[model samples]
Target: MAQHDDDRRFSLRHLLGLVSRFARMAAFGALASVAHAQDAVSTPAGPSIALFYGANPPIDELARFDVVVVEPDARFDPRAHPKTHPAWFAYVSVGEVNPHRSYFSAMPRTWLPGVNEAWASHVVDQTAPEWPAFFVDKVIAPLWKKGYRGFFLDTLDSYQLIAKTDTARAAQEAGMIRVIRAIKSRYPKARLIFNRGFEILPQVHDLAYVVAFESLYRGWDASKQAYTEVPQADRDWLLGKAATIREQYRLPVLSIDYCDPADTACGPATAARIASDGIVPYVTDGDLATVGVGPAGQP
Candidate 1:
């Protein structure tokens, strides 16, 4: 009788211990639920951008929107101005380097495929393993520390030429992914915006939050004049790229194109096509800064 009583007591104690362990796990799962609830990005108003130091739109005007894209070298002091603007994306060209940029010195001759005389953006050698890190460390970190929200990766189309349609494409893409992931690891809150670079959509389409489609109708000439053409084939090609991003990534796109600034546009069909595409069209001379904001900075 004594032995049976002892066994019964032991069994009861073991059952209680199991119950305690189960309760602890349930509490832990509840806490994890709370942590996961906090991870979503805050929804804000529409996106806006300024060129040449936000001169086209006063900082105040630019601030009216949720996100503002700016030049990499543009002067900005987030603490100095209003605090509430949700996101500010700084522009950086990863595929190429402008000769005037500080990093141009680190560029090697081996990296230079050639130059686009029209845009004047130097084609850098993305084949270099260290090039992407240099951009993230030098350009991206500084902007994020300065309170810029994310990055506007511009002139990425230049990558198509820098890398031959062989091993270079994959290599260039891997390098860019490394660069973007590095930025996100440090500032996980910052959004990644890719401009052009449509060829690599399969790789980076899902990586970016917003994308800007370029060279729709009026591409700029060396003289900065609006060289206009419908080029239905080109328009269709770009739309196809947009379709890929939307289908693959489900990210919002901000399509940008050049048109005549004055009241006269080269063709009415051009204006209609831009509107139909459901992208933000900036109908101006190639220069975005001039017509966007007046001297007083009224929109």
Candidate 2:
């Protein structure tokens, strides 16, 4: 009887030990899984390859990109819900008025004295008191409500067109600074990207998240319908300026080089040259209907 009782007690002890060991292993495994999940969430993804100035692609196709720039009234096929999607910015231009619109009905007394023949767009007088308010109310507010996370703020360089004298140029730049500051104040969390606003970059660098240069390496030849390399001197000057903005302001530089879609070499070469300067490159058609990849397979 004594022996049987001792045997029973030993078996009970062994079962308890097995249960404790299994519980500890399960707990450790769960903790390791949680740690791995957190690490995956924290790791930053690669820089986004983006498209601009075109109708929105299919939602699944659009999801593949990291950023997109579209007109205020541009339509989306499936209706992009960017707020719930992976991090991306939808940008709208702020400084130039689209020439396609009826100017008189859109805004009274806002257009600058001349039309930009090259783009068929009217430059806005940034100094006009009502200009910023009109933009915020009519453009920025509507887009923000539609779930856009950024502003492209094109035509910051348009000030260069009207500023014939040093004093006039300085005033134009100051006006740009004021408008940018106002946008920043209103939408503190929104991403602000200035397009080729090199002269005004130093003044508004703190307020901007990115600076983009269009046609840095290649541009469309309307006569030949082909891509042409920019002059070496021009390329050197722009690259130098881009480097300064990147290093000094700690801002990322984005380069948009337009190329003839049929020229396979142009896309890869331009993207490589732009990337060599430590700028994110996007090679697209003049109308930006398609996205091109770099030689290194970067988007």
Output the number of the TM-score-best candidate.
Answer: 2
lDDT tens digits, residue span 1-299, model 1: 99999999999999999999999999999988866553211111125433333443456655655566666465665645547563666778777777888878866777777786767778866656776677777887777778777788877767676566768787777766676666777777878778876666676566677877666765655464645654789878877876666556676555555555563544234434554554434333566554332111123
Writing each residue's lDDT as its tens digit, candidate 2 over 13-59 gives: 99999999999999999999988876543332235556645665544
Question: Which residues of candidate 2, in runs, are more than 4 Å off?
Answer: 1-46, 77-79, 83-91, 101-104, 221-226, 294-299
What is candidate 2's CA lDDT for residue 244? 92
The runs of at least 3 residues in candidate 1 whose Cα sits more than 4 Å from the true structure, single-residue gaps closed, are 1-57, 84-86, 264-275, 291-299
Tell me how far the alpha carbon of residue 254 in candidate 2 is from the true structure, in angstroms, after superposition. Answer: 0.8
Residue pairs with backbone atoms closer than 3 Å in model 1 (clashes): 111-125
Residue pairs clashing in model 2 are none
What RMSD value applies to candidate 2?
Answer: 11.7
| Shift in Å, residue 120, candidate 2 | 1.5
- Please give each candidate's TM-score: 0.70, 0.76
